[model samples]
Target: MPRSNWVSRVVGWDRPRREQPAWLHGDRQHLLPTHSHTDRHVVSTIPAAQVTKVALKLRHLVESAVPCDLDESEITRAHSSIITPEVVQAAKEAGGSEYRACVVFCLLICKAWFRQQSVVELWDADLHRGREVACEVIAKKLIETEDDTSFLLHNILLQRYSILVDGEPTYPANAIERAVDLHAVDVITSSGYQKCVDHLWRGWLVQDEDNPTTFVDYANRDKISFFTHLDPDRIRVPRYQNATQLLVTIAFLVLFTVAVNTPNPSGRLDVAEVLLYLFTLGFICNEVTKVYKAGYRILGFWNAVNGVLYTLITASFVLRMVGLGQPLDHGHEDPAHHREFYRTLSYNFLAFSAPLFWCRLLLYLDTFRFFGAMLVVLKVMMKESLIFFALLAVVIVGFLQAFIGLDIVDDMAVDEYGVIIKAMANAVMQSPEFDTFGRFSPPFGTLLYYFFTFIVMVILLNVLIALYNSAYEDIYQNADAEFLALFAHKTLQFVRAPDENVYIPPFNLVEIVLIALFGWWMPAGRFEQLNDAVMSCCYAPVMVAAAAYESNVARAIHRNRARGGSGDDYDDVVDHEWERVACAPETQVDFEAEGWDKVCEAAKSDIEVEPAVQEVRQLRAEVEELKRMLAEISRAVGAAAAGEESK
Candidate 1:
């Protein structure tokens, strides 16, 4: 059957039904080339000469390819027949700037002009072999330009059309093949792919040398952090590594607790007091750096929590220092009581601050991505369940109001706070007041109690559970991306590391204050500054070198393969780092090093039969359609089963 007939059959089934064809929806109407120019009349009177001028200007703009200018919709209107195949063909043959401009224009028509709808629709609708012509022009222009436009074109086609230029399943578009190409375009070229990876890695590594004004612009730091994995060894301050800082901070917190709890003989300044001052100074400095780098608004929920914790810890330390050795005589009956009051205040502050210190563990979420993903899932669940919680709150409040109006809240010994709390407890039959519901006049209280209990405990709670489960499932589906994004953000926090000497365990406190007051002026010459910037980062240079080495090797391999030399010819020049990274127990294996072997394996795995799996799937689909047609014809012709006559 023809493609149109299949669409017609599918269209017939699109009557307010579940799982209807996507074209039935307005959002997907662009997938069909039969688009109604609703606003055509407004532009119809515009002269073709004027339209052509606009089209040529747009072509120049596309060729120049300014990122900000790409979003402008002015050029989209000039995508009429004025910029036809002949124009694109002539532009291609001319082979100057016109070649690249024409390619981008065609891509704009295929992707951006139609709001990124299906490009194959052009061929499906028999729009003058648009798909075939576009592919040829694109390929020719790609050879001529050899620019990043090829990346964009390849991404659009592979992502939107499932059409790989050099690979199998080459294009002559199919509806089923189009449905499955949903993943983002992260890789482009087979050769020098390692260079792409290295570029991405280096770009992600937020540097101290980066200009604060242009950092965001140069780095594209605003993108979702989920794609790049952070390396702690490569991205850390001079003295304090990520794990070391975490451990030392934990030790300081512990010492602070010990100092508070232990009795101080003769009331002398102890280890705890010194530790307190150092921790306070370091915490304040660290937080200030974070705010300066990213601004406070970009800080996460946990960052805010950490801020509160730091404040409490600082206040408690300040209070301890202030109260120490001071005679409590001003308007105080008992000095002991006054001393006890400040002690209690400081203790309370430290106690509240202690639990929040554990939030620092969230920084290492990249190491344990599963737990990070769970936290994300919980966050999503909480966000989704808020409305449900509010609805439940309203119902519970209504029940409480009814109880108070009847003056029965007092009978249950439930106060204002207890009304909300104890009512919920009673709903679950967990409160003593649950048994006294029948004591009300007539059956009003009993009816209300059961109704509230059923609605709140059974119905609403179940609804919340369902909502949470749905959210968790959604998060789980995209857990990898979510977790990676978290890791990426966490890595950014480490980018702007302190230049001060590494704070040694107990001595770091005194050193912190010294560094604050004097470290800036204590700097050496240009060599020292360069050393601090480049060599101070322990693993960063090594990582970059490894990537560079791999990229070179990849280029060499590609060069050899291109010249018809065996890939084995270049295998003798072994990369130790590549081997280490590949063989490591925990590290992700890079497919680039393996090159064509990985690609061949992937291609083999994609095969369902020894021949083309796509062809097999397509044939199977057609056979099923034929079977369905035969059955329908038999039913319509009122034919008896041949098996019955044989029997």
Candidate 2:
């Protein structure tokens, strides 16, 4: 059967269908002469069947060459598709057979042109406009594709077409052009006949006058509708998901209250205080930036505001340094001003390091730095912002309280005030390092200073770090569980036959809320009930899964080692770390060197790690606690029953 007959049969020739006979004449490498433009004058004298076969083969070359089934799902599931005729024609001409190849082509093309302004123009127009505009504009650009086309044209044509030679060819003028466009010029290597490429030199192929542009457009409907939903596939997220996200964001934002404060002494703003303010403004800007669609329009003002705050704080630091006669250069750095200048420089540099890149000339680079730096700032501000601000406020309000109680600085000296300010500053940097020492050292401080610092940095930090670390870990850990659920959903699709219209996967609201309700947390109890039952249920499965994964990895490594394969394929350090991470027992790892000799004698490197070292950290704690409780219970029971028997 001829290739044209197949399409004719599939589309069902409305008037009448007929079978057309055809035969494969030549391969891609071989050349068989056909006919010229003048030869076509006598084409009718040749077999009518041969002409039909050629037309059919050409149609197949156009349709089956470019596959586009790659993103059929995207079209079916997008927030109302905005398909243009260019997209439609490309897909149709490409046909379903070449879907994956076309997708790869589109990806390659987008990768190449993403930074080009013209691509943005094309995308915006294609994504937003009516089909009518796209067809005309796309046709013009389609011509330009001759110059900047995706590699698909070459790859596809190479798969389908053959070079012709030997006899007089009766090829269509357009077909010759198509051959040349596909670089079939390799067919002609003879001397001085690149010009005899005559009848084959057609430059354009006409598009089907009637073609599908916007395959289906529902760009105007609300995404998810609980009442009269037409298509769930078109909606990206679930109906109530927006509400869940909004509430969650609000809860997170409310934690910012921890950072608020009163004021500085002299009722004036100070450098650290202003820096904290700029940090807050930047955070709010970051939250607004989290919005995907409206980030630019709605958050633009906040971005500007954040930029101003940074500039002002930087300027204030410079002005203050100038007022104190600190060195702007070597001229002002004499002994009289050297200490002040160094202190001022250190303070300003630490505070403003993230903002120096904010100039419009380097805005993109600044934006990249800003987001990461802001996240760190958010963490710092969430816990200490309140304390910091409160201290600031106390600086203002505390003086008033003391004044009302008849305290006066007028009679006292400047050093007294300096001592008070210095005390507050010293109280800010304490940490776990301080836990080792009962008292302060030379560079450390007095009992009072360390005590206040301990309250602010050490003790409060233990309390807050315990809280934040627990929350962050819980959320981070649950992310894997969500991925597991998605994996399960996909696996289920393969296991069971499903209706195409049915959604195989359920909505994925980050299960942080449900996990919260279950009381499986960092400290394991603050938010919900103090029930270890719930905690065990939540954590046990993850632990079991982790154990299984570690066992498999250990097996793979041992197998690789036994085969005498290149261990170079694996990073020994990374593998060691992974074992420390993935298979490391919940028990604390033993850093103690007591078992070094015994470990060296072990056959497998993995087995060399003392299991006790890992398990002992956790199990020891529990077992010890259990033993104590059981002893106490035994005593209580013995005492109670004895008293009863004696009575």
Candidate 3:
């Protein structure tokens, strides 16, 4: 059936209401175009073959036959050329279907415009606004279609494109990068385009039920709140999930403390030690599952921290086990000493990991506004510090080589490299050890040390400070948007690993065992039922709270609607006030009597007075015109009187 006909049929009331359409329910397999085995993971709804065909058709429509290049001025020409009516028509013809073609064409044009804005200076406000309007229209149409737009938008947001390496047409890596490159974060995150972001969020959250994989939307929610309403069945809400994780983390930390503090001198595992081991194993499994699901993407700073903590705990466990396995002294030199040594080593490793586990609390705490904002700043500053570290490495290497070269006698006094490193580190900390370098090579070594101090302390340290400040200012200046982006990113992390059933930490160990035992032979539906039952049982308390909250919210929504108030009225009002103060004035506005005070106040402000100023200038011009007319009439009268006298 044709796509349009299918849409029409789906909309009609005559059609029997059975299960919702696959597209509507978030199953996109039938909607997405087929791809070759090699390109199976590509999220694009348009076929690869169709992409090439459309590219050819678009190339023919351009006046200049030169190949399109985003880096050069050709991007503007390509954008203009593709949006032309003739080219759009040709693209539609080549697409084998009008609706699909138009959507794909719009995406291609948007991609071009995004690229053009990045490379070219957008001094032309009209041109820029026109392109922006085009993008807005494209986004609007996608939302209206509501069939395959989610998949298409996801393609633009998540997929990377490479022409030379992949033998495909050139395109931006992803919409996010393109927006960032053009310094248009606000445009993408603006309320007018929030539906687009939501669509992208939904796409990221898609979980296939038939063939359940680890990659499932873990943090899917209609609203984000600790006490927000949600369907009873919806246990994967962000706040609830975070709450569960936070509880588990706290439990794990408490267990670790108890286990570490209790004496285990008899080489036997205590209750706390046994429970800690199980929790550690669960956490290890969780990290492994995430790494397997997300691959290299999971190897971030926090994950690295997790890796270190796990390694320490695992080593500690192994050492304890080894010590337990060792035979008694049996008249040997000192069996007690050997066993004590191993025990001490194991405890030391576990004790050292305490700080790391505490720091891990930040991971779950980031859902809060204060922590989320701080995390973003810290993340940015950490990225900035890489440059500082890279330069510092070079300086250290040069200085190390110099100091080593100076130690010609094979000193045999103090560890030469250690002393030099210690001195340099001290200098970086603003406490240079000038006297330490004197023994190496007299005045030359001392002078070199002084120079090193100046370069690192004065230059490199200051540069690092500036980078940190810039990063802090950039994030704080647009704090809300940055936090939203962070929240979205956090939400994405939970869902990136598509687990049909969420098993928080130690619980996941049970899931693994259950899956191993029955998942292979059981029917998918039965397996899902089993998982759902397990989740409900485990998360019964939270689910009950969620159901109660949802019922209340539903009642509130109905009440508001009955009172002739929209559920979103408050949000709309807030958005309107924010836009009035921060955004450019709209061409058309509806003024209400109740809002007259606000309008008057706004008119007095610099941002909202543009229209009023223009009106005032027009009135002044009218007054000048009347004055000129009166003077002309007076001169004419004088001339007529002179003519009469002469006659």
Candidate 4:
């Protein structure tokens, strides 16, 4: 069999094969491996109780080794080459649990190799070298496959080039092709294929600069390594994250509320000053951490909103501190009154930050997706409506000038601003006193007012409504992509977790010094120790309580989902066929009748064209009659010639 045919069969590409020219066969010949890969990595001898866990670990190792840019077809071919009869037999002997199947699948992927000639034409020699090293280890049986847990730590040969992945089978069919096949944007990711969607979820791990498993060899051997979360030492559990976020939010609300309520609140006071300063410090540190992780990518819409809020809060804190520093009996105007003015300015700054802070909540609630999308749609509509309002303003100005010129109203009742306002009101048919336009000279002012009102109220209002409707439809059409982008943004936040030494909010001031000045020189071990020592003593109890609160909330959500509650079904905001179906319900469409109606319309069109076709046929018949007359004339001439020949 030809090499291309062999590769096609291995990957199960069902498209019709084209014959390769003799010259192309030289390029194809080297893709075939010279020897079979017989060293199957199996944990059959391991205890059955620990089998699932070990298999899962092995699967993780295999997937983690896969390079980010590896093609689906290439991986498929490699995996297929490793699935020999011996490997299948060994997999069967080891109880075929889902985890075991996943491990066996990944083991095959690891054992899979390409001929050096296969990828020689490509520029990325490093990717091919990694695969070749993996294949060599499998061929040599250098990896310890006997013990379950021990092998994970001991396998040096496998450690260097091991493929890490989400433990699922990623097939070539899962990819959707446009200009190129995009595997990540699959609408419905089957459990098996979910691991392959790098752009959506898995890809972020490799791209994460903070990931401890940056060294492939270290990750393969490190039992505590995780693809999605931070390293074990720096890991912040999801519940802990929830706790921290809740604490910060509550602190912000409490400090701002008290400060706003204080009598002559904008005046300098020492109340909650320490707490307010601490919160501001934490906010700045967190923003810096995000910037470090994402670099130039930190400039998104939500980030900008948070940046403005941070600026306001910081300004308030600084202003309050300056006010406190000023003496009560300064040489200027009344010192106490000057202090009050400065304090008031500080309070104003704090107060203004509140709405922007609340707006940041939209970033978290984006998982619901539709609400976020609706907010975007509404923003677009408002922008379009501005133009309509501008045109309306032009008309209002014209009417205002006319009303003033005609001297149609009492000056006490209406000034220029009042005239414009009342005209606008009249335009929308909201003012009953628009009858006052009648006070103008006979036919002109009344006609003008009525005509202006009809155009502004009826025509322009409808046009604005139509514009909004179109915008809504346009947004709804691409809501899935919009929501995915939102989700990706959220994913990146966790991908760049804050330093382990940063103090938790309510007392995060220490972090400003630790992170801002000394962060680069601080060892990871020392930082973690410092953070653990401080947190365990100062705020451990509060964090524990917060974690417990988070746990209870989670349990409540699960219970609600179990009971089929209305809002509980949105566990994961994934794109699915059911969501599409639910959004657009079947309306009992008469497809059969509709199809017949289409056929009838087609027949009517054919009938309309039939008269011209019939006229052409009649012309062809007349031509045939002329041809018959010519033939008869030729036969008479032949008879006359016969008579001449007889003479």
Candidate 5:
């Protein structure tokens, strides 16, 4: 195809582009390859020749539907003396629609070629080259002009260029200014195409694809080699990524029993027992931290239950053998209580982790909301992430207050306070508040738990959703309406809620002063009127004021009205009025309201018209009989002609 005749979807036209000439597409011609492209630019000595050719062709295309006389025989013959199958084949790979919707197809190919600085640098090179070929092949079938829409041009180019997008899938950032420069402002993008582009890009890799077998099938192919042919490398996954495959290979180690009758050490501790204790300690800590981070992501009831149950069973054995590896097992008598406490701790920790994991998943889906929610809650709570000591403190105070009274800490006896730590242990599980004093008495500590949960879930959640909604509302309103709508909306809000100025409750100090000043002490309406009078008096003297404005407007409108008239009723009024003004030399009073009075006299006459075109007033009158009859006669004639033509 001749490049001159092709219409670019990117550089859209100013008029309706005509179709390609019939002769150009009578047969198909293979596109001349890059070897045929000249290394040098076109004719440097007379660049004017190429420019003039372009200018004239464009002018002719805009003005007329017919093809221009200018013709290049070599290009024309090359386009015509070819087979059709190659053309159809090229069109198919571009997409089946490209064959029929050639205007858009040409755009894709042309843009691809031009945008490419190197082989495929422009991002649309493959398609652009194809369009150039099509243009040459169908030179005779080209349209002269087309009205281009800027939005359409940008959307078309974005669609043709890539199949994937992240964030907003908008036209490339500079599209607006580029379009204004080219002046292609009328093209409309077809619908539903944007979603396909989004799917191709901004998609996540699935777990199955991360597996070893899927990896080798997609990533390792014996057929592809660098020297043999070029391939699209940016989209490929690397070999090291397969390390993610190891998540599936886990096996849990169970508790091992030691051999009986083994009494062979300095104090009697076995090496296996020491190693076993160390491993167990490390595992418990690791589990705690991991659960804290990934609680919600593990979605199973039994998994949660298992953590607590296992912690209880393991803690029993751990406390029973507390000093087994070392040489001290004297006063530590309650392994069972320790087991139960650890179990409760594990269950609570799991509960905390579950929420954290859910929050993480939400953040992954919506970064803005997740982060905003996090900031609000943290801003409210002041810290993030679990700290062991703080959690221990909360648990101690909380259960103590629940069972023992909160004030009991204040009234500890000398013996009871002697072992401060042991005293805490007394109500640590069974505090005094846990036992009913009477019908139902409770300490402040019990209320704290309910309040904490309420603050986290309800209050903090609402704050986050509120901020997000505010941001979203702003964006949504901006997208739907222009400045005028915003102005109207704000004006309506202002009118509807005059109190929205904010009813600041009167400060007692300010209220005293205001009451003294406004308690029927001053006339506010009179004060405002006096203020306006003083402001206007600073301008012209009253006589000149009325004269300056009224005299000028009166003369001007009369003059303007005179100009509109064919003959002289207004001209007479203008002369009569001007003479009266000139006749007043000293007093400078407008004389002879005579002309105006006479004009009003003819108010009933058809010649007189309202100075202001109040359309509503005009529409209020019934249609004149003559005008009504004329319209009816016209419609009758039109109907009769249609009936005659049909017969």
Candidate 6:
């Protein structure tokens, strides 16, 4: 067998052949009874081809009725007429699968709209509106179904497939990628999607209420909530988790500051120092676990910052320990200097890392919309700057080599390499040192230096500026989409590694001990029970506060519903007016009126050319008919001649 086939068999992609059983032998098989399976327990699945066909028909209907120039009202009407509640319900009923056919239908329609937007010269607002309506309908359905529709929203919709287009496989992209590409932030950030994510996060660590002994897949014992009775409802929110992490980080920073600044004449460990040591150990453990869980993803920019921060702190602590262990008096002339040297080095390392600690606060602060959006812009800019830096590096290396070659005449007197590097760097900073280069190689050196300055200052600098501006403009133009994408990405990060539980730093230190003692040998039920008891005690205050807030919100919603009012009352007239201004008629073009004639002219031309092509085909058919008649005549004449000759 081929290696590929063998590997496939090993992985069970190609099922291995099974030997026939004795019971299935001719006589035995006839005597044995057979059982029939019922459809009642089996889920009905709609074929992918049928779903795609229905989606295409729906797409054609929307496209034909609502052109790019159609008004919002007309577009809404067209979408509403096609994607009616009846149609959605029928699709849902047809598929008894966990990933309902209706969701797949909506996703396909959205994907079609996205593809159109990418291919067209001008984006159709009406098409966009149609997509938005479809998304709204999807959101409504998802919310109504709640956890039941989770498989489609969280798994199937997000699964990438290599779809063939025009007989070749195209790049794989999931629903999230399509939405991001189309700048349809409304879909990913929809209340429905958020609720789905929350459901997934909450279920990350859950217990079986009825059967405690039954093991729950994807359950994390570390994330066991204080109130497991409430299960998902009272599970810790990601935002709350971030907030708690921020508090812990702040506490860690404060402890470090106090520990370093406090005097220790006797070289004995103080309370602050011990507490700081514990915090550092917890942070180190947390980072290690994150790296272990996240793998290569922990190599991102922020994680690099964290790695550096922790490295410095760990080294500083080590140096401090060594310094404390040194004897106060020695046989040397300056006895105290030896110990002071180590202490000074340790303090230097700790002080040097203060800026990084402050910078790390931004990581947690990103939960806020303003900070999150700004971080997205910053991340884009950093990625864009890589291009600039790569080009600059090549330019600098080329110039350095040229300068070195020119300085071969006077090798001993001057450090040509250092001079050239400083000159190039200064030129990049808009400050040129032309005089130093002029004395070394005379005219050629001066000329080269001038060229370098112009290239660095005028050309490369402007290119970098242009790149930054382009990135900034692109992000700001679709600011909402960019922010929502960032938000969704952040939200997914929490639940991506389902096995890694939520043990915020210092608490993780405690979790480490418990895992070692009980995690290995204990039964799943007993282990979960242990985690629940520990979490309830450790997070009593937080759980109580969260429960109270939830109760208040629930009561408010119920009261509003009873009074016939919308649950939310935080709407502002200013926001409403702003939305109106944004979508006003004056701000938009009436493409239907302006471009209708052009469309008609193009259609007429196509119509004219189509008939001419038809005529050519018709003439070809006539010629073929004439040839056939001639062949028949020739055959008949040949037959007659043959008969005459025989007579």
Evaluated with TM-score, which candidate comes out highest? Answer: 3
Higher-ranked by TM-score: 3 or 5: 3
Q: Show where candidate 2 strays beyond 4 Å.
A: 1-416, 431-451, 480-647
Per-model tally of clashing residue pairs: 3, 23, 7, 13, 43, 0
TM-score of 6: 0.60
Q: Which stretches of candidate 1 lie over 4 Å from their true place?
A: 1-249, 252-269, 273-277, 284-296, 311-315, 318-336, 392-452, 492-647
lDDT of 3 at 295: 41
lDDT of 3: 0.58
**Can you give the lDDT of residue 406 in candidate 4?**
63
lDDT of each: 0.44, 0.33, 0.58, 0.46, 0.30, 0.57
Provide the TM-score for each candidate, comma-separated: 0.46, 0.21, 0.67, 0.40, 0.20, 0.60
lDDT of 6 by residue, 235-312 (tens): 345544655677788888898788668756655668887787787788777666555433443457787788898898
Of 1 and 3, the candidate ahead on lDDT is 3
**Residues 481-511, model 1: lDDT tens digits:** 5665544334323332222233333433444
lDDT of 3 by residue, 1-647 (tens): 11223223122222222221221111111111111121234333444445555544443443232223322232223234334444444434544553243333434444454335534654543444444444433333333433553444444343433222146433223333333333344434544234444433423234344322212333333243444433323555555676678888998999999978976877678898888889989988777754443345336788788899999999999988888876655466876556666777889999999999899989888867889889889889999999999999999889878888877554633465678788889998999999887877677788889889999999999999999999999999978777766665555444333334678888887777766666656776787778778887877777777656545544554555665555432232223555545444653344575687687877774543356687898899999998899999999999999999999
Ten consecutive residues with minimal summed lDDT in candidate 2? 198-207
Error of 6 at 204 (Å): 14
- Deviation in angstroms for 151 in model 4? 19
lDDT value for candidate 1? 0.44
TM-score, cand. 3:
0.67
Best by lDDT: 3
Candidate 4, 155-199: lDDT as tens digits:
211121222224421211101110011112222122212211222
TM-score of 4: 0.40
lDDT of 4: 0.46
